[model samples]
Target: MIDPAYVSAMARYNAWQNENLYGAAASLSDEARRQDRGAFFGSIHGTFCHLLWADRMWLSRFTGTPKPSVPGSESSRMIEAWEELAAERQVTDVLIGDWAAGLSPEWLAEDLTWVSGISRRELTKPKAQLVMHFFNHQTHHRGQAHAMLTAAGVKPGDTDLMLVDLRG
Candidate 1:
């Protein structure tokens, strides 16, 4: 249902959006970044942390990497320090890109099974579908974060995937 090219494009888009969001977030005071903004994840910092945590969790499933230590309920606070979070985000972005670059059609075509941490039940699905959800989840939460940043008077630029020049 998906191809490596599509995944690669998404990985690049994810990194680009993250760079813009994190750059805008860096301008805010720590208090402002962490303040509860009534968002689903609480605030910009909280939302970003959750995104990172979720990405790591999904990556762990896709790869053989260790899953994130924190649970979904605590994901919002997964990385408390701003600088550390930013550095980790950069590293995770690269990891996702590299992983996507190496995906094979045979691998993506196979079914994947894993226990659901949230539901506490065994779940199975096509790898392609799960891969699509992985990127989709990032975009979903990033939208929430973009709104929060805008509310804080911080401007994260050009969220449109089409506008991202991935040619390089």
Candidate 2:
């Protein structure tokens, strides 16, 4: 069984990391942020957009929130405007935190069945595993975005989870 505390902590960490990354990314010009740097998502901006789209997609499944209209193949350009993207990111992070705060063992222990947008197939899995995937997906893409930020000459500060100060 997945611990609610761990999910909550991860939600906080996800927000913390996004804030740091977005802050650093703010220093770069729009062209620099969007320039293709050979990352899987092509650029820092593209990767960030993909991350936001994926979050929204998963959150929709998890919370019955509206699923993002963009298809998986087009996630890289879901939000082309930097300002809008950043604002949505903040809102989504808050939503994730709030959702995590309400998580319980009962909810986590159940199974979740949903249609896969990418594969176009029905799938069922433990809700706990799906919750784990939610956070894992964020971390996986953020790492790529972090590298792209570094390549663009932006330092995203420390990324160690243990060092994330959650006391505030």
Candidate 3:
């Protein structure tokens, strides 16, 4: 089981990495960003869209915020435009940071019950473990994005967790 401090630190790392990725992505043209690079999500824009969609879904589960209208299968196309996607990403990152800041040890120790979107079944698990998965999912997709960016001749800076600035 994890604690609020751990949650907060991961949240900070998430936001920091997001900023780096988005900033580097901004340098690419629309066509370049949308080019199929043979990645799972197909392209940089598509991967980012799916990541944002997944973040919203997880946030909705954790905070009771409204979930994305599109399902996971269609996540890569969640947002059509890069500008819109980036804007929503910034907003979502802030929301995640705020939610992490409010997490308590008691909440972390509790269980979270929710219907699985992928399996379409009711499931319950420890909040701490779910939170860990949530952040891990972000890292997983972001790593793909980072590779895509690097292949496209962009540098997103250091991704090491120790490089993240915890101070907000």
1-168, model 3: which lDDT tens digit per residue?
688988999999999999999999999998999999998999999999999998899899899999999989999999988899999999999999999999889999999999998889999999899999999999999999999999999998899997657765
Stretches of model 2 off by over 4 angstroms after superposition: none
**Tens digits of per-residue lDDT for model 2, 1-168:** 678888899999999999999999999999999999998999999999999999998899889999988889999999989999999999999999999999898989999999997779999999999999999999999999889899888888999999987643
- Best lDDT goes to which candidate? 1
Tell me each candidate's TM-score.
Answer: 0.97, 0.97, 0.97
lDDT, each prediction? 0.94, 0.92, 0.93
Per-model tally of clashing residue pairs = 0, 0, 0
RMSD (CA, Å), each prediction: 0.9, 1.1, 1.0
Ranking by lDDT: 1, 3, 2
The lDDT, on a scale of 0 to 1, for candidate 1 is 0.94
Off by over 4 Å in 3: none
